[model samples]
Target: MKKVSVIVPAYNAHDTLARCLGSLVNQTLQDIEIIVVNDASTDDTWEIMSRCEKQFPDKVIIIDGDRNRGAGGARNQALDLASGEYIGLVDSDDYVAPRMYELLYEKAKEGDYDIVDSGYYQEATDTARLYTGDDLTGILDDNKRKKTYCRRRISCYQSF
Candidate 1:
Protein backbone atom coordinates (compact mmCIF):
# COMPACT_ATOMS: atom_id res chain seq x y z
CA MET A 1 0.00 0.00 0.00
CA LYS A 2 1.23 3.48 -0.85
CA LYS A 3 1.49 5.99 1.96
CA VAL A 4 0.04 9.43 1.27
CA SER A 5 0.15 12.69 3.15
CA VAL A 6 -3.13 14.64 3.03
CA ILE A 7 -2.46 18.30 3.64
CA VAL A 8 -5.42 20.56 4.46
CA PRO A 9 -5.12 24.27 5.16
CA ALA A 10 -7.97 25.65 7.23
CA TYR A 11 -9.01 29.11 8.39
CA ASN A 12 -12.28 29.72 10.24
CA ALA A 13 -13.73 26.66 8.56
CA HIS A 14 -15.72 25.20 11.42
CA ASP A 15 -18.79 24.74 9.27
CA THR A 16 -17.13 22.53 6.64
CA LEU A 17 -14.11 21.11 8.43
CA ALA A 18 -15.96 18.13 9.81
CA ARG A 19 -17.33 17.15 6.42
CA CYS A 20 -13.87 17.44 4.89
CA LEU A 21 -12.31 15.38 7.65
CA GLY A 22 -15.11 12.84 7.42
CA SER A 23 -14.43 12.17 3.77
CA LEU A 24 -10.70 11.86 4.48
CA VAL A 25 -11.23 9.49 7.39
CA ASN A 26 -13.49 7.31 5.27
CA GLN A 27 -11.10 7.07 2.35
CA THR A 28 -10.30 3.55 1.12
CA LEU A 29 -6.62 4.41 1.30
CA GLN A 30 -6.13 3.89 5.00
CA ASP A 31 -2.38 4.36 5.01
CA ILE A 32 -2.59 8.11 5.09
CA GLU A 33 -1.32 10.75 7.49
CA ILE A 34 -3.39 13.91 7.77
CA ILE A 35 -1.60 17.20 8.34
CA VAL A 36 -3.89 20.15 9.07
CA VAL A 37 -2.47 23.68 9.24
CA ASN A 38 -4.83 25.91 11.17
CA ASP A 39 -4.07 29.39 9.94
CA ALA A 40 -5.01 31.23 13.15
CA SER A 41 -8.77 30.88 12.86
CA THR A 42 -10.78 33.01 15.26
CA ASP A 43 -13.62 30.51 15.46
CA ASP A 44 -14.36 27.13 16.95
CA THR A 45 -12.27 25.56 14.20
CA TRP A 46 -9.41 24.77 16.52
CA GLU A 47 -11.78 23.22 19.04
CA ILE A 48 -13.20 20.98 16.37
CA MET A 49 -9.67 20.13 15.32
CA SER A 50 -8.76 19.17 18.88
CA ARG A 51 -11.75 16.87 19.04
CA CYS A 52 -10.79 15.25 15.75
CA GLU A 53 -7.26 14.76 17.03
CA LYS A 54 -8.58 13.03 20.09
CA GLN A 55 -10.75 10.78 17.94
CA PHE A 56 -7.96 9.90 15.52
CA PRO A 57 -4.97 10.45 17.73
CA ASP A 58 -2.53 8.42 15.73
CA LYS A 59 -3.54 9.71 12.31
CA VAL A 60 -4.07 13.46 12.85
CA ILE A 61 -1.45 16.13 13.43
CA ILE A 62 -2.52 19.71 14.04
CA ILE A 63 -0.13 22.59 13.42
CA ASP A 64 -1.55 25.77 14.92
CA GLY A 65 -0.42 29.07 13.47
CA ASP A 66 0.16 31.95 15.84
CA ARG A 67 -1.01 34.57 13.36
CA ASN A 68 -3.05 34.66 10.19
CA ARG A 69 -1.04 32.94 7.52
CA GLY A 70 -2.51 32.77 4.05
CA ALA A 71 -3.20 29.51 2.20
CA GLY A 72 0.30 29.41 0.78
CA GLY A 73 1.86 29.83 4.19
CA ALA A 74 -0.37 27.20 5.70
CA ARG A 75 0.43 24.71 2.93
CA ASN A 76 4.12 25.41 3.41
CA GLN A 77 3.71 24.43 7.05
CA ALA A 78 2.05 21.19 5.99
CA LEU A 79 4.78 20.54 3.48
CA ASP A 80 7.31 20.74 6.27
CA LEU A 81 5.49 18.05 8.24
CA ALA A 82 4.61 15.76 5.35
CA SER A 83 6.48 12.45 5.14
CA GLY A 84 4.71 10.46 2.46
CA GLU A 85 6.10 9.71 -0.97
CA TYR A 86 2.92 11.15 -2.51
CA ILE A 87 1.34 14.38 -1.34
CA GLY A 88 -2.29 15.52 -1.74
CA LEU A 89 -3.77 18.89 -0.98
CA VAL A 90 -7.41 19.45 -0.03
CA ASP A 91 -9.28 22.55 0.93
CA SER A 92 -10.92 22.62 4.32
CA ASP A 93 -14.30 23.40 2.76
CA ASP A 94 -14.17 20.85 -0.06
CA TYR A 95 -14.98 17.18 0.30
CA VAL A 96 -13.97 14.29 -1.93
CA ALA A 97 -15.10 10.76 -2.67
CA PRO A 98 -13.90 7.99 -0.34
CA ARG A 99 -12.00 6.17 -3.08
CA MET A 100 -10.54 9.27 -4.72
CA TYR A 101 -7.00 8.76 -3.48
CA GLU A 102 -7.05 5.02 -3.96
CA LEU A 103 -8.07 5.29 -7.60
CA LEU A 104 -5.69 8.14 -8.32
CA TYR A 105 -2.77 6.26 -6.79
CA GLU A 106 -3.51 3.26 -8.96
CA LYS A 107 -3.83 5.40 -12.05
CA ALA A 108 -0.49 7.08 -11.39
CA LYS A 109 1.26 3.75 -10.92
CA GLU A 110 -0.25 2.20 -14.04
CA GLY A 111 0.42 5.25 -16.19
CA ASP A 112 4.08 5.43 -15.04
CA TYR A 113 3.85 9.17 -14.82
CA ASP A 114 5.75 11.29 -12.33
CA ILE A 115 2.67 13.48 -12.04
CA VAL A 116 -0.86 12.54 -13.05
CA ASP A 117 -3.43 15.15 -13.91
CA SER A 118 -6.91 13.71 -13.57
CA GLY A 119 -10.31 15.29 -14.03
CA TYR A 120 -13.07 15.42 -11.48
CA TYR A 121 -16.81 16.05 -11.48
CA GLN A 122 -18.43 19.28 -10.23
CA GLU A 123 -20.20 17.48 -7.37
CA ALA A 124 -23.48 19.13 -8.35
CA THR A 125 -26.62 17.53 -9.81
CA ASP A 126 -25.19 17.81 -13.30
CA THR A 127 -24.80 14.65 -15.33
CA ALA A 128 -21.36 13.10 -15.49
CA ARG A 129 -19.16 13.53 -18.56
CA LEU A 130 -16.02 11.64 -19.46
CA TYR A 131 -12.92 13.69 -20.27
CA THR A 132 -10.93 12.13 -23.07
CA GLY A 133 -7.49 13.50 -23.89
CA ASP A 134 -7.92 16.44 -26.23
CA ASP A 135 -5.45 18.58 -28.14
CA LEU A 136 -5.95 21.95 -26.46
CA THR A 137 -3.10 23.68 -28.26
CA GLY A 138 -5.24 26.54 -29.54
CA ILE A 139 -7.79 26.43 -26.73
CA LEU A 140 -6.22 29.29 -24.80
CA ASP A 141 -3.85 31.51 -26.77
CA ASP A 142 -2.83 33.27 -23.60
CA ASN A 143 0.74 31.98 -23.39
CA LYS A 144 3.21 29.53 -24.85
CA ARG A 145 2.73 25.79 -24.12
CA LYS A 146 6.24 25.43 -22.70
CA LYS A 147 5.71 28.18 -20.15
CA THR A 148 2.14 27.12 -19.33
CA TYR A 149 3.25 23.55 -18.71
CA CYS A 150 6.22 24.68 -16.64
CA ARG A 151 4.18 26.72 -14.18
CA ARG A 152 0.80 25.02 -14.19
CA ARG A 153 -1.96 25.95 -11.82
CA ILE A 154 -1.68 23.98 -8.60
CA SER A 155 -5.34 24.18 -7.62
CA CYS A 156 -8.23 24.47 -10.05
CA TYR A 157 -9.96 26.95 -7.74
CA GLN A 158 -7.08 29.43 -7.57
CA SER A 159 -5.14 31.00 -10.42
CA PHE A 160 -1.94 30.86 -8.39
Candidate 2:
Protein backbone atom coordinates (compact mmCIF):
# COMPACT_ATOMS: atom_id res chain seq x y z
CA MET A 1 0.00 0.00 0.00
CA LYS A 2 1.08 3.57 -0.58
CA LYS A 3 2.25 5.48 2.47
CA VAL A 4 0.30 8.59 1.54
CA SER A 5 -2.49 9.44 -0.87
CA VAL A 6 -2.49 13.11 -1.90
CA ILE A 7 -5.72 14.38 -3.37
CA VAL A 8 -5.45 17.29 -5.80
CA PRO A 9 -8.60 19.09 -6.85
CA ALA A 10 -8.23 21.08 -10.04
CA TYR A 11 -10.67 23.38 -11.81
CA ASN A 12 -9.49 26.00 -14.31
CA ALA A 13 -6.01 25.95 -12.84
CA HIS A 14 -4.05 25.07 -15.92
CA ASP A 15 -1.38 27.68 -15.27
CA THR A 16 -0.49 26.45 -11.82
CA LEU A 17 -1.36 22.76 -12.15
CA ALA A 18 2.00 21.81 -13.60
CA ARG A 19 3.91 23.53 -10.84
CA CYS A 20 1.76 21.88 -8.20
CA LEU A 21 2.12 18.41 -9.67
CA GLY A 22 5.81 18.94 -10.20
CA SER A 23 6.26 19.60 -6.52
CA LEU A 24 4.41 16.43 -5.59
CA VAL A 25 6.24 14.24 -8.04
CA ASN A 26 9.53 15.48 -6.73
CA GLN A 27 8.70 14.94 -3.07
CA THR A 28 11.32 13.29 -0.90
CA LEU A 29 8.65 10.79 0.10
CA GLN A 30 8.59 8.54 -2.91
CA ASP A 31 6.06 6.09 -1.51
CA ILE A 32 3.12 8.30 -2.29
CA GLU A 33 0.28 8.32 -4.78
CA ILE A 34 -1.16 11.50 -6.27
CA ILE A 35 -4.85 11.45 -7.17
CA VAL A 36 -5.68 14.36 -9.46
CA VAL A 37 -9.35 15.12 -9.88
CA ASN A 38 -10.33 17.30 -12.81
CA ASP A 39 -13.53 19.03 -11.82
CA ALA A 40 -14.82 19.69 -15.32
CA SER A 41 -12.24 22.27 -16.22
CA THR A 42 -13.09 24.31 -19.27
CA ASP A 43 -9.43 25.00 -20.00
CA ASP A 44 -6.56 22.63 -20.77
CA THR A 45 -6.36 21.30 -17.24
CA TRP A 46 -7.50 17.89 -18.38
CA GLU A 47 -4.79 17.76 -20.98
CA ILE A 48 -2.15 18.64 -18.45
CA MET A 49 -3.41 15.94 -16.13
CA SER A 50 -3.36 13.50 -19.00
CA ARG A 51 0.26 14.30 -19.64
CA CYS A 52 1.12 13.89 -15.98
CA GLU A 53 -0.71 10.58 -15.94
CA LYS A 54 1.43 9.39 -18.80
CA GLN A 55 4.63 10.84 -17.39
CA PHE A 56 4.17 9.30 -13.99
CA PRO A 57 1.81 6.44 -14.64
CA ASP A 58 2.69 4.60 -11.45
CA LYS A 59 2.59 7.66 -9.19
CA VAL A 60 -0.27 9.69 -10.70
CA ILE A 61 -3.94 8.75 -10.94
CA ILE A 62 -6.18 10.96 -13.03
CA ILE A 63 -9.90 11.15 -12.46
CA ASP A 64 -12.01 13.11 -14.89
CA GLY A 65 -15.41 14.32 -13.77
CA ASP A 66 -18.27 14.67 -16.22
CA ARG A 67 -19.83 17.62 -14.46
CA ASN A 68 -18.31 20.58 -12.67
CA ARG A 69 -17.91 19.82 -9.01
CA GLY A 70 -16.44 22.28 -6.59
CA ALA A 71 -13.10 21.69 -4.88
CA GLY A 72 -14.74 20.03 -1.87
CA GLY A 73 -16.68 17.67 -4.11
CA ALA A 74 -13.53 16.77 -6.00
CA ARG A 75 -11.73 16.03 -2.75
CA ASN A 76 -14.65 13.85 -1.64
CA GLN A 77 -14.41 11.86 -4.85
CA ALA A 78 -10.69 11.26 -4.38
CA LEU A 79 -11.21 10.34 -0.73
CA ASP A 80 -13.42 7.45 -1.81
CA LEU A 81 -10.64 6.06 -3.98
CA ALA A 82 -7.75 6.62 -1.61
CA SER A 83 -5.73 3.49 -0.76
CA GLY A 84 -3.00 4.83 1.46
CA GLU A 85 -2.61 4.82 5.21
CA TYR A 86 -2.79 8.63 5.30
CA ILE A 87 -4.88 11.06 3.28
CA GLY A 88 -3.62 14.47 2.15
CA LEU A 89 -5.56 17.31 0.54
CA VAL A 90 -3.90 19.86 -1.77
CA ASP A 91 -5.15 22.46 -4.20
CA SER A 92 -3.94 22.47 -7.78
CA ASP A 93 -2.83 26.07 -7.41
CA ASP A 94 -0.67 25.37 -4.37
CA TYR A 95 2.47 23.35 -3.87
CA VAL A 96 4.36 22.16 -0.83
CA ALA A 97 7.96 21.83 0.24
CA PRO A 98 9.76 18.72 -0.99
CA ARG A 99 9.96 17.34 2.54
CA MET A 100 6.57 18.46 3.83
CA TYR A 101 4.88 15.06 3.60
CA GLU A 102 8.00 13.20 4.57
CA LEU A 103 8.29 15.20 7.76
CA LEU A 104 4.58 15.04 8.55
CA TYR A 105 4.44 11.29 8.07
CA GLU A 106 7.48 10.82 10.24
CA LYS A 107 6.03 12.96 13.01
CA ALA A 108 2.69 11.18 12.82
CA LYS A 109 4.32 7.77 13.09
CA GLU A 110 6.58 8.87 15.91
CA GLY A 111 3.73 10.30 17.97
CA ASP A 112 1.05 7.88 16.77
CA TYR A 113 -1.19 10.83 16.11
CA ASP A 114 -4.68 10.31 14.77
CA ILE A 115 -4.38 13.51 12.73
CA VAL A 116 -1.55 15.94 12.08
CA ASP A 117 -1.70 19.53 10.92
CA SER A 118 0.91 22.18 10.11
CA GLY A 119 1.42 25.80 9.17
CA TYR A 120 1.29 27.11 5.62
CA TYR A 121 2.76 30.07 3.76
CA GLN A 122 0.62 32.20 1.54
CA GLU A 123 2.04 32.22 -2.00
CA ALA A 124 1.27 35.88 -2.48
CA THR A 125 2.76 37.09 0.81
CA ASP A 126 5.19 34.31 1.83
CA THR A 127 3.86 34.44 5.38
CA ALA A 128 3.84 31.30 7.49
CA ARG A 129 1.09 30.81 10.07
CA LEU A 130 0.15 27.96 12.29
CA TYR A 131 -3.21 26.50 13.18
CA THR A 132 -4.63 27.10 16.64
CA GLY A 133 -4.69 23.90 18.61
CA ASP A 134 -3.31 22.45 21.83
CA ASP A 135 0.06 23.91 21.03
CA LEU A 136 -1.23 27.47 21.10
CA THR A 137 -0.78 27.68 24.85
CA GLY A 138 2.99 27.50 24.46
CA ILE A 139 3.08 30.41 21.98
CA LEU A 140 0.51 32.84 23.34
CA ASP A 141 -0.99 33.82 26.71
CA ASP A 142 -4.30 32.25 27.72
CA ASN A 143 -6.54 35.15 26.74
CA LYS A 144 -4.68 35.97 23.56
CA ARG A 145 -4.48 32.34 22.54
CA LYS A 146 -8.20 31.92 23.04
CA LYS A 147 -8.93 34.92 20.85
CA THR A 148 -6.61 33.79 18.08
CA TYR A 149 -7.88 30.25 18.22
CA CYS A 150 -11.44 31.46 17.86
CA ARG A 151 -10.57 33.14 14.56
CA ARG A 152 -9.33 30.01 12.84
CA ARG A 153 -9.61 29.72 9.07
CA ILE A 154 -9.69 26.56 7.03
CA SER A 155 -6.19 25.63 5.88
CA CYS A 156 -5.10 24.15 2.59
CA TYR A 157 -3.28 21.02 3.74
CA GLN A 158 -3.89 18.18 6.19
CA SER A 159 -2.56 14.66 6.77
CA PHE A 160 -4.31 11.78 8.53
Candidate 3:
Protein backbone atom coordinates (compact mmCIF):
# COMPACT_ATOMS: atom_id res chain seq x y z
CA MET A 1 0.00 0.00 0.00
CA LYS A 2 1.01 3.60 -0.43
CA LYS A 3 2.56 5.16 2.65
CA VAL A 4 -0.16 7.78 3.02
CA SER A 5 -3.34 8.76 1.30
CA VAL A 6 -4.31 12.43 1.56
CA ILE A 7 -7.99 13.26 1.23
CA VAL A 8 -9.21 16.68 0.09
CA PRO A 9 -12.82 17.74 -0.30
CA ALA A 10 -13.48 20.76 -2.48
CA TYR A 11 -16.60 22.88 -2.76
CA ASN A 12 -16.41 25.98 -4.93
CA ALA A 13 -12.76 26.38 -4.02
CA HIS A 14 -11.58 27.54 -7.39
CA ASP A 15 -9.08 30.11 -6.16
CA THR A 16 -6.74 28.07 -3.99
CA LEU A 17 -7.26 24.51 -5.21
CA ALA A 18 -4.43 24.55 -7.73
CA ARG A 19 -1.87 25.83 -5.29
CA CYS A 20 -2.99 23.31 -2.71
CA LEU A 21 -2.59 20.46 -5.20
CA GLY A 22 0.80 21.78 -6.22
CA SER A 23 2.09 21.48 -2.69
CA LEU A 24 0.80 17.92 -2.34
CA VAL A 25 2.20 16.92 -5.71
CA ASN A 26 5.56 18.19 -4.56
CA GLN A 27 5.57 16.53 -1.15
CA THR A 28 8.98 15.40 0.13
CA LEU A 29 7.61 11.90 0.53
CA GLN A 30 6.56 10.75 -2.92
CA ASP A 31 4.96 7.49 -1.77
CA ILE A 32 1.60 9.07 -1.15
CA GLU A 33 -1.75 9.37 -2.88
CA ILE A 34 -3.91 12.46 -3.07
CA ILE A 35 -7.63 11.78 -3.34
CA VAL A 36 -9.50 14.99 -4.21
CA VAL A 37 -13.29 14.96 -4.02
CA ASN A 38 -15.38 17.56 -5.81
CA ASP A 39 -18.62 17.83 -3.89
CA ALA A 40 -20.76 19.03 -6.74
CA SER A 41 -19.02 22.35 -6.91
CA THR A 42 -20.78 24.97 -9.07
CA ASP A 43 -17.48 26.67 -9.89
CA ASP A 44 -14.37 25.66 -11.83
CA THR A 45 -13.23 23.29 -9.11
CA TRP A 46 -13.91 20.26 -11.27
CA GLU A 47 -11.86 21.65 -14.12
CA ILE A 48 -8.92 22.35 -11.86
CA MET A 49 -9.11 18.86 -10.38
CA SER A 50 -9.16 17.44 -13.87
CA ARG A 51 -6.12 19.42 -14.83
CA CYS A 52 -4.22 18.28 -11.79
CA GLU A 53 -5.16 14.70 -12.58
CA LYS A 54 -3.67 15.13 -16.04
CA GLN A 55 -0.51 16.58 -14.60
CA PHE A 56 -0.03 13.96 -11.87
CA PRO A 57 -1.93 11.08 -13.35
CA ASP A 58 -0.46 8.42 -11.11
CA LYS A 59 -0.55 10.11 -7.74
CA VAL A 60 -3.75 12.17 -7.92
CA ILE A 61 -7.14 10.48 -7.76
CA ILE A 62 -10.23 12.50 -8.68
CA ILE A 63 -13.70 11.82 -7.27
CA ASP A 64 -16.64 13.77 -8.67
CA GLY A 65 -19.82 13.88 -6.62
CA ASP A 66 -23.03 14.03 -8.58
CA ARG A 67 -24.74 16.03 -5.83
CA ASN A 68 -23.63 18.03 -2.86
CA ARG A 69 -22.39 15.67 -0.12
CA GLY A 70 -20.86 18.33 2.08
CA ALA A 71 -17.33 17.90 3.41
CA GLY A 72 -17.97 14.89 5.59
CA GLY A 73 -19.66 12.88 2.91
CA ALA A 74 -17.02 13.75 0.35
CA ARG A 75 -14.34 12.58 2.74
CA ASN A 76 -16.23 9.37 3.42
CA GLN A 77 -16.40 8.73 -0.31
CA ALA A 78 -12.67 9.12 -0.70
CA LEU A 79 -12.08 6.98 2.36
CA ASP A 80 -13.74 4.10 0.58
CA LEU A 81 -11.22 4.25 -2.27
CA ALA A 82 -8.11 5.03 -0.29
CA SER A 83 -5.47 2.30 -0.36
CA GLY A 84 -2.77 3.75 1.83
CA GLU A 85 -1.31 2.55 5.09
CA TYR A 86 -2.08 5.88 6.71
CA ILE A 87 -4.74 8.48 5.97
CA GLY A 88 -4.14 12.23 5.81
CA LEU A 89 -6.70 14.98 5.45
CA VAL A 90 -6.21 18.38 3.83
CA ASP A 91 -8.72 21.08 3.06
CA SER A 92 -8.82 22.12 -0.56
CA ASP A 93 -7.97 25.69 0.42
CA ASP A 94 -5.01 24.67 2.56
CA TYR A 95 -1.49 23.93 1.40
CA VAL A 96 1.03 22.07 3.54
CA ALA A 97 4.81 22.29 3.86
CA PRO A 98 6.73 19.94 1.59
CA ARG A 99 8.31 18.01 4.46
CA MET A 100 5.11 17.84 6.51
CA TYR A 101 4.29 14.25 5.62
CA GLU A 102 7.89 13.12 5.72
CA LEU A 103 8.20 14.24 9.30
CA LEU A 104 4.84 12.82 10.29
CA TYR A 105 5.47 9.49 8.59
CA GLU A 106 8.84 9.19 10.21
CA LYS A 107 7.31 9.87 13.59
CA ALA A 108 4.62 7.29 13.03
CA LYS A 109 7.14 4.62 12.13
CA GLU A 110 9.64 5.51 14.84
CA GLY A 111 7.11 5.78 17.62
CA ASP A 112 4.88 3.00 16.27
CA TYR A 113 1.98 5.34 16.82
CA ASP A 114 -1.38 5.14 15.12
CA ILE A 115 -1.53 8.94 14.82
CA VAL A 116 0.84 11.84 14.34
CA ASP A 117 -0.17 15.49 14.53
CA SER A 118 1.30 18.73 13.20
CA GLY A 119 0.83 22.46 13.43
CA TYR A 120 -0.67 24.85 10.91
CA TYR A 121 -1.19 28.57 10.47
CA GLN A 122 -4.26 30.69 9.93
CA GLU A 123 -3.40 33.54 7.57
CA ALA A 124 -5.44 36.65 7.05
CA THR A 125 -4.73 40.01 5.47
CA ASP A 126 -2.75 41.17 8.48
CA THR A 127 -2.60 38.28 10.90
CA ALA A 128 -1.15 34.78 10.84
CA ARG A 129 -1.75 32.50 13.79
CA LEU A 130 -0.60 28.95 14.51
CA TYR A 131 -3.53 26.58 14.16
CA THR A 132 -3.63 22.83 13.23
CA GLY A 133 -3.06 20.06 10.66
CA ASP A 134 -1.86 16.41 10.22
CA ASP A 135 1.29 17.10 12.18
CA LEU A 136 -1.22 18.60 14.61
CA THR A 137 1.71 20.60 15.95
CA GLY A 138 0.74 23.82 17.61
CA ILE A 139 4.42 23.11 18.20
CA LEU A 140 5.90 26.40 19.34
CA ASP A 141 9.37 24.89 19.41
CA ASP A 142 10.48 21.38 18.52
CA ASN A 143 13.18 21.48 21.18
CA LYS A 144 11.46 23.39 23.99
CA ARG A 145 7.79 22.54 23.44
CA LYS A 146 6.27 21.10 26.61
CA LYS A 147 2.63 20.49 25.63
CA THR A 148 0.58 21.33 22.60
CA TYR A 149 -3.20 21.20 22.87
CA CYS A 150 -4.43 22.96 19.82
CA ARG A 151 -6.88 21.25 17.48
CA ARG A 152 -7.94 17.62 17.24
CA ARG A 153 -6.01 17.30 14.01
CA ILE A 154 -3.71 14.48 12.95
CA SER A 155 -0.84 14.64 10.54
CA CYS A 156 -1.89 11.19 9.43
CA TYR A 157 -3.78 8.15 10.78
CA GLN A 158 -3.55 4.44 10.24
CA SER A 159 -6.78 2.88 8.96
CA PHE A 160 -6.12 -0.42 10.63
Candidate 4:
Protein backbone atom coordinates (compact mmCIF):
# COMPACT_ATOMS: atom_id res chain seq x y z
CA MET A 1 0.00 0.00 0.00
CA LYS A 2 1.25 3.49 -0.81
CA LYS A 3 1.41 5.86 2.14
CA VAL A 4 0.28 9.46 1.86
CA SER A 5 1.09 12.53 3.93
CA VAL A 6 -1.77 15.00 4.31
CA ILE A 7 -0.41 18.38 5.37
CA VAL A 8 -2.57 21.14 6.89
CA PRO A 9 -1.33 24.66 7.55
CA ALA A 10 -3.27 26.18 10.37
CA TYR A 11 -3.22 29.59 12.00
CA ASN A 12 -6.18 30.89 14.05
CA ALA A 13 -8.48 28.41 12.36
CA HIS A 14 -10.09 26.76 15.35
CA ASP A 15 -13.59 27.08 13.95
CA THR A 16 -12.86 25.15 10.76
CA LEU A 17 -10.07 22.84 11.81
CA ALA A 18 -12.37 20.26 13.37
CA ARG A 19 -14.52 19.98 10.29
CA CYS A 20 -11.46 19.69 8.07
CA LEU A 21 -9.86 17.07 10.27
CA GLY A 22 -13.16 15.21 10.55
CA SER A 23 -13.27 14.81 6.78
CA LEU A 24 -9.74 13.45 6.76
CA VAL A 25 -10.43 11.01 9.56
CA ASN A 26 -13.26 9.44 7.58
CA GLN A 27 -11.16 8.87 4.45
CA THR A 28 -11.54 5.42 2.89
CA LEU A 29 -7.81 5.06 2.50
CA GLN A 30 -6.33 4.34 5.93
CA ASP A 31 -2.67 4.24 5.03
CA ILE A 32 -2.04 7.92 5.58
CA GLU A 33 -0.58 10.34 8.07
CA ILE A 34 -2.07 13.70 9.05
CA ILE A 35 0.45 16.47 9.60
CA VAL A 36 -0.89 19.61 11.22
CA VAL A 37 1.33 22.71 11.28
CA ASN A 38 0.14 24.86 14.15
CA ASP A 39 1.23 28.31 13.01
CA ALA A 40 1.19 29.88 16.48
CA SER A 41 -2.53 30.15 16.82
CA THR A 42 -3.80 32.18 19.77
CA ASP A 43 -7.24 30.63 19.66
CA ASP A 44 -8.35 27.18 20.82
CA THR A 45 -6.65 25.50 17.87
CA TRP A 46 -4.09 23.80 20.07
CA GLU A 47 -6.75 22.65 22.53
CA ILE A 48 -8.88 21.15 19.78
CA MET A 49 -5.80 19.65 18.25
CA SER A 50 -4.85 18.07 21.57
CA ARG A 51 -8.16 16.24 21.71
CA CYS A 52 -7.82 15.15 18.10
CA GLU A 53 -4.24 14.06 18.62
CA LYS A 54 -5.25 11.86 21.48
CA GLN A 55 -8.01 10.32 19.42
CA PHE A 56 -5.69 9.69 16.51
CA PRO A 57 -2.38 9.43 18.23
CA ASP A 58 -0.96 6.93 15.77
CA LYS A 59 -1.96 8.90 12.68
CA VAL A 60 -1.57 12.52 13.77
CA ILE A 61 1.68 14.45 13.83
CA ILE A 62 1.52 17.99 15.17
CA ILE A 63 4.41 20.31 14.39
CA ASP A 64 4.20 23.30 16.69
CA GLY A 65 5.90 26.42 15.41
CA ASP A 66 7.42 28.76 17.95
CA ARG A 67 6.55 31.79 15.82
CA ASN A 68 3.84 32.41 13.31
CA ARG A 69 4.91 31.26 9.86
CA GLY A 70 2.81 32.21 6.91
CA ALA A 71 0.97 29.56 4.94
CA GLY A 72 3.96 28.88 2.69
CA GLY A 73 6.39 28.50 5.56
CA ALA A 74 4.04 26.23 7.51
CA ARG A 75 3.62 24.00 4.48
CA ASN A 76 7.41 23.88 4.14
CA GLN A 77 7.70 22.73 7.75
CA ALA A 78 5.24 19.90 7.13
CA LEU A 79 7.04 18.94 3.93
CA ASP A 80 10.33 18.59 5.76
CA LEU A 81 8.73 16.13 8.20
CA ALA A 82 6.78 14.14 5.62
CA SER A 83 7.91 10.57 5.05
CA GLY A 84 5.24 9.29 2.69
CA GLU A 85 5.56 8.59 -1.03
CA TYR A 86 2.74 11.02 -1.86
CA ILE A 87 2.12 14.41 -0.28
CA GLY A 88 -1.28 16.13 -0.23
CA LEU A 89 -2.12 19.71 0.74
CA VAL A 90 -5.42 20.42 2.50
CA ASP A 91 -6.39 23.88 3.59
CA SER A 92 -7.58 24.03 7.21
CA ASP A 93 -10.88 25.58 6.17
CA ASP A 94 -11.81 23.27 3.27
CA TYR A 95 -13.25 19.81 3.59
CA VAL A 96 -12.95 17.06 0.97
CA ALA A 97 -14.81 13.89 0.07
CA PRO A 98 -13.84 10.63 1.73
CA ARG A 99 -12.54 9.10 -1.50
CA MET A 100 -10.45 12.16 -2.43
CA TYR A 101 -7.11 10.60 -1.67
CA GLU A 102 -8.06 7.08 -2.70
CA LEU A 103 -9.03 8.12 -6.21
CA LEU A 104 -6.09 10.48 -6.58
CA TYR A 105 -3.62 7.88 -5.39
CA GLU A 106 -5.08 5.24 -7.68
CA LYS A 107 -4.80 7.54 -10.68
CA ALA A 108 -1.22 8.43 -9.77
CA LYS A 109 -0.24 4.80 -9.34
CA GLU A 110 -1.86 3.68 -12.61
CA GLY A 111 -0.73 6.60 -14.78
CA ASP A 112 2.81 6.66 -13.29
CA TYR A 113 2.58 10.44 -13.14
CA ASP A 114 4.96 12.52 -11.08
CA ILE A 115 1.99 14.83 -10.49
CA VAL A 116 -1.70 14.22 -11.15
CA ASP A 117 -4.42 16.83 -11.14
CA SER A 118 -7.71 14.98 -10.87
CA GLY A 119 -11.14 16.04 -12.09
CA TYR A 120 -13.53 17.76 -9.66
CA TYR A 121 -17.13 18.92 -9.63
CA GLN A 122 -18.75 21.98 -8.14
CA GLU A 123 -21.77 21.15 -5.99
CA ALA A 124 -24.20 24.00 -6.29
CA THR A 125 -27.86 24.29 -5.35
CA ASP A 126 -29.00 24.93 -8.92
CA THR A 127 -26.24 23.50 -11.09
CA ALA A 128 -23.38 21.03 -11.37
CA ARG A 129 -20.65 20.50 -13.95
CA LEU A 130 -17.98 18.03 -15.03
CA TYR A 131 -14.60 19.39 -16.12
CA THR A 132 -12.33 17.87 -18.73
CA GLY A 133 -9.16 19.53 -20.01
CA ASP A 134 -5.61 19.08 -21.24
CA ASP A 135 -2.90 18.70 -18.64
CA LEU A 136 -0.07 21.16 -18.38
CA THR A 137 2.47 20.27 -21.05
CA GLY A 138 5.30 21.38 -18.78
CA ILE A 139 5.96 22.80 -15.34
CA LEU A 140 6.25 26.56 -14.56
CA ASP A 141 4.88 27.55 -17.99
CA ASP A 142 2.90 30.50 -16.67
CA ASN A 143 2.70 32.31 -20.01
CA LYS A 144 0.82 29.44 -21.64
CA ARG A 145 -1.81 29.08 -18.90
CA LYS A 146 -2.02 32.83 -18.31
CA LYS A 147 -2.69 33.55 -21.98
CA THR A 148 -5.29 30.79 -22.17
CA TYR A 149 -7.06 32.05 -19.05
CA CYS A 150 -6.76 35.73 -20.01
CA ARG A 151 -8.29 35.03 -23.42
CA ARG A 152 -11.41 33.62 -21.69
CA ARG A 153 -10.73 30.22 -23.28
CA ILE A 154 -10.41 28.33 -20.00
CA SER A 155 -13.48 26.33 -18.94
CA CYS A 156 -13.04 26.61 -15.18
CA TYR A 157 -13.94 29.65 -13.10
CA GLN A 158 -10.92 29.62 -10.76
CA SER A 159 -8.47 29.52 -13.72
CA PHE A 160 -5.40 30.52 -11.80
- Candidate 2 per-residue lDDT, tens place, 1-160, comes to 8989999999998899999999999999999999999999999999999999999998999999988889989999899889888998888988889999999999878877656667788767777777546644333568765665576554556666
- Give the Cα error of residue 71 in candidate 1, in Å: 0.9
- Candidate 3: give the clashing pairs: 117-135, 117-136, 118-134, 118-135, 118-136, 118-137, 119-137, 134-154, 134-155, 135-155
What digit string (tens of lDDT, one per residue) describes model 1 on residues 76-151? Answer: 9888888876788888887777788777667666755344444444555453333334443234445544544654
Worst 10 residues of 3 by lDDT: 151-160
Clashes of each: 0, 0, 10, 0
TM-score of model 2 vs. true structure: 0.86
Q: Over the full model, what C-alpha lDDT does candidate 1 score relative to the true structure?
A: 0.72
**Better model by lDDT, 2 or 3?**
2
Model 4: per-residue Cα lDDT at residue 128: 41
Q: What RMSD does model 4 have?
A: 4.7
TM-score of every candidate: 0.78, 0.86, 0.80, 0.79
Q: Who is ahead in TM-score, 1 or 4?
A: 4
* lDDT tens readout by residue for model 4, 89-139: 877876777888887778778867555544334444334444334544345
Ranking by lDDT: 2, 3, 4, 1
Off by over 4 Å in 2: 132-151, 154-156
Error of 3 at 56 (Å): 0.4
Candidate that scores best on TM-score: 2
